[model samples]
Target: MIPLQRISVSTRTQTLLTRWTKHVQDTGATTKAARAQWKKAKAPKAKVRTALESMARGAVRCMYCDDNRATDIDHFEPLDEAPLRAFVWLNHLLACSYCNSNVKRSQYPVDADGACLLVDPTAEDPADHLELLLKSGRYTAVSGSAKGEETIRVFALNRPDLVKGRMDAFSRACSNMRDWHQLCQEADPEADRVAQALLDSPFIDVVHAMTRLKPSVAAVVVGPRTVPALDAWRSAHGF
Candidate 1:
């Protein structure tokens, strides 16, 4: 998961959410009340869903899984824990149905110090906590990052199909990089198109990991011959 920017919703929509929050609080701040109110907003109104999608990753991918299309507005902090923040924009995350309901559910882990152990993509960069293994399509928690471990566990980030997607994305990215580099060398008119295609590709984090590759990277998916293409691609994209 990458860090996301929360763009503002329409002023009228914001007012509606604010009013909903107050309405829920007035009803004793119960979980049932929060769910009922959110159901009304999410189903019929849909302003929150649209706003969250606008803040999502490429092609409106889930903020947690980053694979499937996001269709749910997840409460990063579970509704039971922070009932008052139910309609708060800051707590909302765009997520897929699987990640929002099946995977995460209501599992909210906190460290002994009472600090949240889940990575909030809008609040923190996932790179600081998690390291993606491009070749194997797995993630390792960075040293001293419990949040990364929990996030991986909660979202099932290393699931087989998803891992395959990342692995496949690596190969495609390498091919695209070679093509992009060739275009750059020739000053082809199609270079911009190729560049935009890369930006729109799935498993964008893999593309990101490729750009972050350095001499210290001992086990990358690509081999020695592709290093120059990778470097050239990085330069072409100003990475």
Candidate 2:
């Protein structure tokens, strides 16, 4: 999981959200009412659009699967059951609509400790609990706990199509890097020219995989000296 840079909400958006939250708090509004307020306030649409654009900018990739086209707002906690958190900025995330609706539905934390399993793209590193199966392109929880298992199952990380997509992205990224390296090997090719070529053709997965493999590649190609800087680029834009 990459640390997401929290974009400050515009004053107008913040005002709308605050008013909507107050309405919910005062009236104990039904979910539909809350949703209507969100729509009327025009905060949700803007927030959703901003979140999607942020995901596209960085290789934030999907939490469930590595698909790059995340276009919906996902609640780390189910908004229906945990309505109090609905407007929480940190709880909001960009998701592919399919993963948010089909697999995640109303599934939420079962107990205080059970909450640990939910992936927080902005807080936790996904690599800690989850690993990609190179052969099958599936995701599995290395830590065998209820939260981990439930998270994996709920997100459908093992979906064949999603796995294939991740693998395909990884393969393309590797191939690009290999090609770049081969080009560099050519007799005294211009370093500035090579760097410019990489900068021009930005592939999210390829850049991320390259960083993981060799920080020097990042330093040479992207000029990030620390992990935080690398993460900043990844969270803001994936490739």
Candidate 3:
């Protein structure tokens, strides 16, 4: 998983959240009341919605699958068991619905010694424990540890459809890279234009996959020395 940047909420949303939090803390209100308070405290609703959007900026792709559309707020620990952490921003994550539903909801982490097996995309790099098998498009555990196994199991990285999708994405990306290289070798002055054309191509999944294989290529083509922008572009476009 890629690193994420925490976005700050607007002043109005912050004030509303603070008041709602206080109400929850002081009165030990029902979940319905808490939600209602959060909703009713703000006017226009757009400010709160914008604040939620801000909170989602720079989050990594889903831990499980590749349906990277708009992300929903997810609880690291289930709200029913960890009620105090329900509204805690630190325990919240921006995730795709597919992953949130298919593999990860309410799945509490296992403890092995002092280690936790579940992958926390916000806190750790997934590449450290997970590696993509190019042939099968499945994620495998390079490290022989419970954490690695747990991560794969929880994410369903070996699922057939997911593997096929990743492979297809990787294949398309390779083709694009070859085409771009051919364009670059043409000795034309419009090399940058050609690069931009590749960026605007519909097959961004391939672009994202190629970047994972050759970061330098992405640096040259995308021209932004940052990973977040590339990731965001990939997710936003369903690449």
Candidate 4:
């Protein structure tokens, strides 16, 4: 999964959150209250969704799988588990229904020291924990990091469909980069369109993985001709 950057909520939303959280903290049915407030707090939810959509990568994709379009505001720390953080912006992330509701519903794994074993893409780089094999579109934990392993298991990051999606995305990237390069070679202004096409493609982490691949390795997978275009796009975007 690609890393995500968190953004701010509006002042009114922030104030609403503070009020809701304080009430929850003071309530007898804290989790219930949080849930109730979440349903009632329409304005805050809409603004949070907007902020997350802007911060989201590749057409507002899920922060966990980065494959499906994000539609749910997931509690990074599940509301049931951490009621106090229910309205906290920092504890929120955009996710797809499959990942948020079906796979990772309130599943928060932790180590013996109480450290989070699940990798939060917003808090830390997922690549540090998980090494994505570009060709196979499978994720293997870097040095078998527990966090990476858990994240994969929890989200089914290497599920067959997901793997195939990633592999297909890589293939598309290679073809797209070649087109982008052709436009750039001719100094065509429309190269921007191809660049945007690359961005619009699903499973965008493939571009990042290819860019970071060793020159000799990348030559074999993404091809020697496509490398320059990928690099140029990456540089132009300041990624």
Candidate 5:
């Protein structure tokens, strides 16, 4: 998961959600009841989900996995803990069924300090807490951050299929970059097209891994590191 800029919902929708939340609160209903109400009243609305999918790169990928097609709206804060935010636009994220139903499924673990342990892609830059293992396409938590550990556990971010998917994407991206480099060596104008394709690839994290430049949030966690292969690749491209 990467950080995503959440889009604003229509004012009419926000007002309706506020009123609905207030009504649910007034009833003194159980979390389960509130969730049921949210599903009944809001889950079927396509416009809100369309907006979220728009945020997930025009519906091609899940906001969580960044690999699968987004098929559901995942509540960043599970309704069991923060039911009031159930219909709030910022709390919603596009997710795949595997990440949403099979893995996360209402599991919101918190640390002993009572702080949420899971990563909220909209609120946190995931790279700050998580690192990608390029060789295996698996994820590891930064030593001091429980957020990454918990998120990996809850989302099964290292599940074999997902790892394989990431590895495949990384391989494809590397191949394209190499081809682009070859084109440049031959003084071919097509090098630009190849470079553009790399930029446009859905597996953007691959490029991020190959470059030293990273989101500021990541710098705070990992500091600076020298990966010889990546550094060599970047230098060859004069990047």
Candidate 6:
């Protein structure tokens, strides 16, 4: 999962959420009971979904896997588990059907000490807790963070199809970066255009990591194992 900026929603929507939350709190209902009420009410209509989609960078990809187009809004704090939080705007994330329905449907695991273990991409940087293997496109848990492990398990981030998808994205991004490097060598006017294009590429984070002079968390996750041409370009340009 990539770090995402929280987008602003209109005051009208915020007011609605604030009012609903007060109503839920006034009833003194347990989270489970509040969820039951929500199910019957069918709240968070189209407007809420639209705001969430905008938060997912126009719903270009799932916030969890970052491998497929996001098609649904997932409750970061599952409704049944934390019903008062159900309609809260900050608790929403955009997800693909496979990640939301097939894999992570309402499965909220907690650590032995009872802390929620899943990563919330909006609240934290995933690279701080997870590592990506370039060759296999699998995620590994960073020490001391249960967030990374549980997220991978619940979301099936290492499933074969997802691994293949990541590998393809990585390869394509690297190829583009290589082209950008060659153009830079001749001081070509087109070099800036290629650089901008890299920002728009799928899995563009890998290229961002490659171009930095210092080792970044993203670079450590995918590298220290070098692609020779890409490494040479990074060394020359990043310095």
Best by lDDT: 4
lDDT for position 127 in model 5: 85
Q: Please state the error at residue 107 of candidate 5 in Å.
A: 0.7
Q: Point out the higher-scoring one by TM-score: 4 or 5.
A: 4
Off by over 4 Å in 6: 22-44, 57-59, 184-198, 204-239
lDDT per model, in order? Answer: 0.82, 0.57, 0.55, 0.85, 0.72, 0.71
Query: Can you tell me which runs of candidate 2 are displaced by over 4 Å?
Result: 1-3, 8-12, 55-63, 112-116, 184-239
5 or 6: which has the higher TM-score?
Answer: 5
TM-score against truth, every candidate:
0.91, 0.70, 0.65, 0.94, 0.77, 0.76
RMSD of each: 2.2, 6.8, 7.3, 1.5, 5.6, 4.7
Cα RMSD, model 2: 6.8
- Indicate whether candidate 2 or candidate 6 has the larger lDDT: 6
lDDT of 4 by residue, 1-239 (tens): 87777777778888977887887777754678788778887877887888889998878888888889999999988988888888898988999999999999989999999888888888888889998898899999989599989999999999998999999999888888878778888999998988887786778888778777876687787777777877776677534
The sequence of per-residue lDDT tens digits that candidate 5 reaches over residues 163-220 is 8877887777666765676777788999878776665566555566556444454334
What tens digits encode model 3's per-residue C-alpha lDDT throughout 64-132? 354364365666665544554445555666567866776777776768564557767557655667666
Candidate 4 colliding pairs: none
Write down the TM-score for model 6: 0.76
Better of 3 and 4 by TM-score: 4
Stretches > 4 Å off in candidate 4: none
Clashes of each: 0, 8, 2, 0, 0, 0
Error of 3 at 71 (Å): 4.4
At residue 23, candidate 1 shows an lDDT of: 81
lDDT of 1 by residue, 1-239 (tens): 77777787778887888889998888889898888777776532488777777777678888887788888888988998888788988888888899999989988999999899998988888889999988898988999888899999999999888899999998998888888878878989898899888877677778877888775662345777677778777776633
Report the lDDT tens digits of candidate 6 across residue range 1-239: 66777787789988877777776787775776666556654455465777766666322678888767888778877876887886788888888999999999999999789888898878887777777766566778888767888888999988998788778867776676667667877789897787666554555444533454244453554444434446655655441
List the candidate numbers ranked by lDDT, top first: 4, 1, 5, 6, 2, 3
